[model samples]
Target: MKYSLLILTLLLTFSMANAQKIYSVDYENQADVKVFVVDYANQADLKVFKVKYQNQAGKNNGKWFFTKYANQAEKKIFFVKYQNQADLKIFFVDYKNQAGWQKNFKKSLLY
Candidate 1:
């Protein structure tokens, strides 16, 4: 029973490691992912929803929690002015259900 509990703890830790906890860095050089906000949903690689809590964040599925600290985030991103300079393109959606990948090929950038 003790060993099972330990395994569960380990599994949870590894699972949370990929949680969409994001930190926006001031500098592009400090970013793990360079992102661009697209004007239209069809132009985006991912349709994102901003979750209110860390627990509400998705597993690289576009539901992100913007962390107050960089250390708390799984991935740090910088917003680029142009789409050409971005590693990923995203469009913010009003509803949580609207959040998801439009083009999954760029999904590994967050992972």
Candidate 2:
């Protein structure tokens, strides 16, 4: 039973590690989510934390790791010229603990 539990835990962790990889696109029209980088954390609908490892990234809690290729990304994001045109507005928080969705309604955009 202990070995079975360990196997299950490892499988879950491995699957999660490959999830939530993001790609930034040059054009807003090509994006799954049109995003705006807010100047202040208070101005954001989400507070993002850029994780160094892909295993550390998660859904809607603002943990992101950018991938170099679009094919490798689970989410493709484009930066909008205006905040009003954005589907999601985010601020890059300095601390990992500060990362999360400020607006619950916008959570679906990331997931």
lDDT (10s digit) by residue, model 1, range 1-111:
999999999988876775799999999999999999999999999999998877678898999999999998889999999889999999999999999999989999988
Q: Which stretches of candidate 2 lie above 4 Å from their native place?
A: 1-18
Candidate 2, residue 10: how far the Cα is off, in Å: 5.2
- 1-111: candidate 2 lDDT, tens digit per residue: 999999999988786765578999998777899999989988899999999877788765788989899987888999987999989999998889999888888888877
By summed lDDT, the worst window of 10 consecutive residues in model 1 runs over 11-20
Q: Pick the candidate with the highest lDDT.
A: 1
Task: In model 1, state the lDDT of residue 56.
Answer: 76
Clashes of each: 0, 0
lDDT (CA) for every model shown? 0.92, 0.86
In model 1, how large is the Cα lDDT of residue 53?
76
